[model samples]
Target: MFNNLGNLADMMRNAGKIRETVEKATESLGQLQVEGTAGGGVVTAKANGRLELLAVRIDPKLLADGDAELLEDLVTAAVNQALTKAREAAAQSLSSLAGGFPIPGLSTLLGPGGGGGA
Candidate 1:
């Protein structure tokens, strides 16, 4: 009975450590940024590791062309690219926090590029 209680305590402590590590990693990730471009650099987007869109830029040439649909497509592509980069950065951060050890369910949680090294 005493051994079981000790084991439970140890498990709880490890769980606390994991939670702390995750929180720190998440906070750190938010400070990182990534950029993505589309339409041969006519459109660009920037995002944070938290996957939040920061800013966007469009070439004045594209604006002058005034094709609404084309501009929309370019913007979409840029945003998607930026998001992909953000996910990759996040995965890298989490992997480091895990000490490169494969954390169960972490890969799935991180999505496609959220595994292995950062």
Candidate 2:
């Protein structure tokens, strides 16, 4: 019982440090960038770890083809892939913040698919 109480006390003492680390990790997410591509690189999307779409690029050839539907499909695929990568990157950041402590509801806090969405 005394050991458990000591452990609790230790946790309390470290709570502030943990919160600060988490905050820094969250902030760093914005700096993390990832890219996804589709249609053999005809379409590429970039996103940050926060899951915000940064930019999308399309091959000039695709635009010249005038296939709106195909262009739309490729854009969608690339964006989704970019977001997926962002989620993974964010998860990695938060996981490192956790430092192996199994914080209950942490995954839920990250939002659907175990990574926070924009």
Candidate 3:
């Protein structure tokens, strides 16, 4: 009983550590910026590992015509590219911090298996 109690306590402590690590990691992500471009750089977006879009840039040439469909596509591409960059940066950062230990559900957490994440 005592051993089990000790193990449980250890797990609780580990959980807290992991929480702290994640908090720090996410905060760091905001500090690091990753840029993603689409349509041959006609559209661009900047995001952090937290997938927070900090900025978006659109080429003036593309804006003149104002084709809603093309504009939408470019925006989508830029955001998607930014999201990919954010994920990559997050994975790299987590890997470095976790010594290559898997991030538990990050990959599966965001992919199709996410099952409607929060």
What digit string (tens of lDDT, one per residue) describes model 1 on residues 1-118? 5866775666567987887888787788779999999999999999998788999999999999989999999999999999899888888778877765566666665567676733
What TM-score would candidate 2 get against the native?
A: 0.81
For model 3, state the Cα shift of residue 114 in Å: 11
The predicted structure with the larger lDDT, 2 or 3, is 2
Q: Sort by TM-score, best first: what order?
A: 2, 1, 3
Question: Which pairs, if any, clash in model 1?
Answer: 92-118
Candidate 2, 1-118: lDDT as tens digits: 4856776677679998877887788788899999999999999999998778999999999999999999999999999999888888788678766754544555654556753322
- Please identify model 2 stretches exceeding 4 Å from their true place: 1-9, 102-110, 115-118
TM-scores of the models, in the order given: 0.76, 0.81, 0.71
The residue-level lDDT of candidate 2 at 45 comes to 99
The better-scoring model by TM-score among 2 and 3 is 2
- Regions of candidate 1 where Cα sits further than 4 Å from its true position: 1-12, 101-118
Measured with C-alpha atoms, the lDDT of residue 87 in candidate 1 is 88
Each prediction's RMSD to truth:
5.3, 3.8, 5.4
- Top-down lDDT ranking: 1, 2, 3
In model 3, pairs of residues that clash are none
